[model samples]
Target: MLDRSESALRVVVRSKFYRSAFLALLIAGIGLSAATPQLTLFLVRDLGTPLPVAGLYYVTNLAAPVAGFLVGRWSDRSHDRLLWFRVCAVIGSVGWLAMAAAQTVWLPFVISTVALSLAGGSMAQLFAACRDELSRHPTKAENRVIATIRMAFTVGWILGPVLGSWFGGVFGLRALLVATAACVFAQMLPLGGQRVERYEDPGISPLPEGRRRLDHMMPLLVFTAICVLAMTGDTIKFGYLPIYMAEQLHVSDSVRGAVIGIQPLLELLMLPAVARLADRYGPLRIMTVGAALGLAGNIAYATSSSVGGLFLGQALTAGLWACVGALGVSIAQQLYPEGVGTASGIFLSSIPLGSAIGGAIGGIGVAIIGLPHVFFVPAGLTTLALVAFVVLTARLSVRMKA
Candidate 1:
């Protein structure tokens, strides 16, 4: 039994589908993370925009994920996933092209909103494609594949800020925007061969002859919604943390960079362990713990008076974030035995949706109530999310027993 179990583990570790998924995630993380941190800096420092105005600029970005969700659902009904994905990438490139030409914040902001929305659409399509691939090889459990994806994203983030800082020093922010667009387009490269059967829900009911398996997928949708709310709190740190550090505590750029850099590296290192825990303890438990961590981390940030306090708080939050992020998708995948394409689109788009919400809220808080309060909002939200997560898990557990 021990030898058989060890062999099964080895097969999972060496699977090609998981390997490709990890690579796609890695490329995504490195590219987006490298470019995004510097966007506000570009607006404020380079374009001579005020912080409040920059905040508003971020507010407009929330529309992208909504559009992505809609487009993804539509695609599930009728559309070529790869073709639409490529088109969205092209649109994302155009957004960058416009940003490169901007002399004012409005121009870049307008383009970024559209471009980001398109990028969201592209990501939705990409995930649906990945889901299709995973389903083909679904004989094995998928928890590790999900963790591998999150780790890739963290790895990208590790690269993102370093690259942003470097480009900000060399070619200026506009050039960096152009470079980001180029990378998004480059992500369009052929991933090579599709293996899984595309999932299509029969209808909405399993009773009727041609009816769909609605009950099987409903739990997944509920979980996805819960994840969306939890993620909203999780995303605040990235979009606003550096600015918070700089403004509230008078942190130097170098220190801010270190704090930001530390997050992804920590995530990259800890994800495998978190993945193991998700498998052993359960994804639900892992996610609940993550939400609690978010609550604590945000509260620490809100009350902290020192730089070390901030970093430590952020690090704690990152560990929890990794746990939830790694497990959430796996849970969602398990929920949808059919309609992997639709489910992947819905599940993946939640992150961008949450980020959009967090960014808008964080931007507003920074502009009005102040930086310290930014953490407070996320803390409150995360606390609420923890309650929701607990309730959801409890219900799921009950269902499993019944």
Candidate 2:
């Protein structure tokens, strides 16, 4: 044990990079997260949009990450991570403002696709910057450092939903959107004029000849594919859990809310431990374990008819996200080792991409299999992906050992 808590952690605690990056992530998380829990409701109930039209809102989720990936790639080339971060936040704020003032039916779609999606790339830039900052001090535990920063965002998500719900109810959805915009703009304050260097490891060993580029990219793509599948399961749970509780389990509002909130809260608690585990057993093995647990968790939700079962299932799935969300970026950065910005962008984009898939899958699966068991759809798909990952990694490992 390196007593990293006293040494590296203290360094993180005292550094300006940690303070600014942590607070920016925290603020941005709250801003974006606060708006999400009520998006469908705002679209349908307040805006008078039809259910079918409202369902199309998830198109924004798919669109944002594509723009984010591009912004990240640009940052690597432009070497202006800080500039994009601030610019994206400003544009995202304008998007929220547009959303608040939206009188036309089609305005939200345009703003989200054109403006806010660019803002979605902001977090990647910040994380890329954080990676650069970490490069300055090799003594720091990289996994733990990144994990610690992510936990701030996790914490914000934990609190944001509650506040958003209350604030929206009391002050109206428009006011809530305005407040969220303010929060988005505030992300720039903590990071104003802050230096954000681009960094990649020069120590990465070259791959075997002829297959260098593709082979080098395999691990990054593999892990990202895993995240995509995992988030699909998560997206299913998130969209359906409340509906499931009301229609099937017949649970009260408080109980349903508790179950909805439990996983992220659990993720906050699990991050440090998973970080330590990555320090020991490595991230990919841990990610595999997480996938296994997520598979089991989804199965639990599919089979059960009771509230307790949902709780148990949610608690189990926390392991997967905790491992993936924290370690996934580092794994991508390490595997790429040429561009942290692009690596992080592609990896972070998995959530939205999987979300786009999850929306379609959840709709079709529910139509066919119905409630509770609809979960098995994502569970089964994830199983297939997991098997592929295992086979590919095993072959890759054998090739390396040879």
Candidate 3:
């Protein structure tokens, strides 16, 4: 009874701001989660697109980061995340609707690349608003807040594929797209009436675009690059792992599903704990450890194919992503505290950017070295990223001291 009560209490989010934000991300995640996995199949089965063309769909996702960065900068400059967020939500709705109505390959591709790309930034706005809200409602557990919000999104990812599979089989892909649009539209509801507490002074004008801020930010930008590289490994493993499972390991589809599903599930469970530890030990140190774990996981993939080996690899890689997905945005927000919108946007943008890079690298790796040895590529990339991160951090510290 006591344990159950504690667990129940642990799950509850007390703040209205947090609860609403959590709910909104969950909805958005569901909308995104459901559509994305089915897109290739939808193209092949519904649109009669060739497998090669469907495979190239990863290129279209590159638009999200580019569009989101612009949106994030716009929201920061305008100081009206609310308006832009709503506009994005509206755009997302229209984009999904357009996708659903698309009868030709060219039309849906255009909608995804253009409209959905713009719509993707709505999440950046949401993260920025949440950051702004906490400024008003101050909390020490900011990392926890971000992690819980991410956990909400993870939950949606877990459910989205399953629900999408069911709905696609039953009501059809068109209905799933319509439902995805509804989820996108509903994102605006949480923060629709919410407002930010903007600080301004009549005596002091805005800070000029100056050298000081750039010097301070350059290392953090380097840090963001490190994260993108680190995350790219996760994407590479994700894109190729199922193929690896079927081909190299001779694993059944069920086993492949379990292996593929393991990381997100473990990520959900580990995120808050990782967040708590991050607050204690520092996100930098924790994330560094996560990077190390990713490198280890990649080596595990390259080295062995036994069940125990696979489990260790999955468990460690989950730790890698748990750190990134849970803490990456918050780290960016903290680093660039003055421009939460822009910082959040940049962090959000890194994901699709990382995915695009990862997909390209994975494809090349498969061709060059064969699929069995491809994990070594990510292992090598993560090691290089970690070395660069250490060098950059040391330089930043030395410069600060001087």
Taking all chains together, each candidate's TM-score versus the true structure is 0.82, 0.92, 0.90
Residue range 1-402, candidate 1, lDDT tens digits: 112123323544576645655565666665677677787788888889998687666566567546655666565655455656666778877777777777876887677666666566665566666566555555333455566655766777777777877886899887887887777777655344534334444553322123345566578777777766666755567666776778767889889878877766777777877776765667887888888887888888787778888888878878776876677655665565454445556677677667768877776776787766678887777778889889888888644211
Model 1, residue pairs in steric clash: 29-156, 30-156, 33-160, 34-160, 203-212
Q: Where does candidate 1 have its weakest 10-residue lDDT segment?
A: 1-10
In model 2, residue pairs whose N, Cα or C atoms come closer than 3 Å (at least 3 residues apart or on different chains), thus clashing, are none
lDDT of 2: 0.80
lDDT of each: 0.67, 0.80, 0.77
Arranged by TM-score, best first: 2, 3, 1
For model 3, the stretches where C-alpha displacement exceeds 4 angstroms are 1-12, 198-217, 393-402
Residues 177-262 of candidate 2: C-alpha lDDT, one tens digit per residue = 99999999999898668776665456755333457756766677776776787779877888887999998788899999899889
Best by TM-score: 2
After superposition on all CA atoms, what RMSD does each candidate show versus the true structure?
4.2, 3.1, 4.4
Output the better candidate (1/2) by TM-score. Answer: 2
Order of models, best lDDT first = 2, 3, 1
